[model samples]
Target: IVLQNCMDTNEPDSDGLTPLMHAAAGGHEEVVGLLLSHGARLGDRDNRRRSVLHWAVLTYREAVLRLLLKHAATDDPLLIDAYDESGCSPLHAAIDSGFEIGVSILMEFGVNI
Candidate 1:
């Protein structure tokens, strides 16, 4: 129904979060796959310039992060290095949040330290 309605996949909510971001943050891998298949923009940023990858890492959504990385634009450095208003990269967020698995996953994906 969401795709049939042509809902703006890139549109942000009041919190500057798109559906992709929310799905990734919540570790909803199936939803992430569905959204990506429906042409959801991987490069969309929140008001803080944070991408869905940032949300995934911050929330320790390892599976979602892996799914996102697979579909993310290879040319877009922001997917790995996205910094929020506080200048925290996805890797930094993982490390700061004490999510060891998240940190390792980001590192495996070759995120800039």
Candidate 2:
């Protein structure tokens, strides 16, 4: 597996997007799980300062959003409401993208409105 060979699971690409961010954005649940288990940093942000949660919501990846929420650390309250460079929170992204399920999931996870 690429993970087996790679040293840093949290390493970002030229665009500042980490593998976990990609998997979350693409709705690759299994890959996201694997990466997380392998020590991927959920807090890693893209060049635009979008968290993995943001990518999941922006891409309408509902299942990925749920998975991320389930794995997210409750201690980091800011994680749920992280703002991107454009000032879009995951909840805002979900509502703006018309991802009803995403909005519900984010609300269930306690995201601020």
Candidate 3:
């Protein structure tokens, strides 16, 4: 299914899930590819200021995370400087969720602890 352009880049949906967030949270590699091809904004944040990486790490969605990293023009954005409303980032989320795979993925993408 073709996701609408607005829908692809739109902010978080119900339950604070963006297309990028959903793709990352669910480990949907194809969906993540479609979203990126549709020019979805990688840095788009949810209501909590959590980017795709945040949800990816939170849910340990490894497949989606790797796809996103591959398609991303930036190896690592200024995500290190970004924080959620509660002053947390994807790294923090991974640590909190105890997702070792997620943490490693984030680190591989050049995100510092």
Candidate 4:
């Protein structure tokens, strides 16, 4: 029932993020794919107006980011010019978290300094 549940629970949380959003944010490509197959809306955003791509970058999940990009579900306009309420974008978060590989991955996608 868990898989079925995950398939059905595409609803947003208090922060307005669905299962797909969380999966993408954490770079859970498999989960993201699963949710997508179940019709999870790709354009959903969190309370901060961040899309799945934004969260994926912040979390430094390269696989997830790539998967999202492949699906054209990620634009990440805030890639370099965004800041969360705490004053941090996905890139900033990746750097602050000491995810050097993550920073590099984001750069490959054109996230500016």
Query: Which candidate comes out best when scored by TM-score?
Result: 2
lDDT of each: 0.82, 0.87, 0.73, 0.69
Q: How would the candidate models be sorted by lDDT, starting from the highest? A: 2, 1, 3, 4
Q: Candidate 2: list runs displaced more than 4 Å.
A: none
Q: Which residue segments of model 3 deviate by more than 4 Å?
A: 2-8, 14-16, 73-76
Clashing pairs in 2: none
User: Top model by lDDT, which number?
Assistant: 2
Model 4, span 1-113: residue lDDT tens:
43655545557889888788778876678888877666776566678877676688767788887776656525334434455667676677777788887788667767767
Expressed as tens digits, the lDDT of each residue in 54-91 for candidate 3 is: 77777778887677766553744675446888999878
- Model 1 lowest lDDT segment of ten: 70-79
- Candidate numbers, best TM-score first, in rank order: 2, 1, 3, 4
lDDT of 1 by residue, 1-113 (tens): 56679988777998889998988888889988998888788888888888888899888898998878767646364578777788888888888899898888777777877
Report residue 48 deviation for candidate 1 (angstroms): 2.0
Alpha-carbon runs more than 4 Å astray in model 1? 73-77
Clashes per model (N, Cα, C within 3 A): 0, 0, 0, 0
Please write out the lDDT profile of model 2 over residues 28-60, one tens digit for every residue: 999999998888888888999999998998888
How does residue 81 of candidate 2 score in lDDT? 90
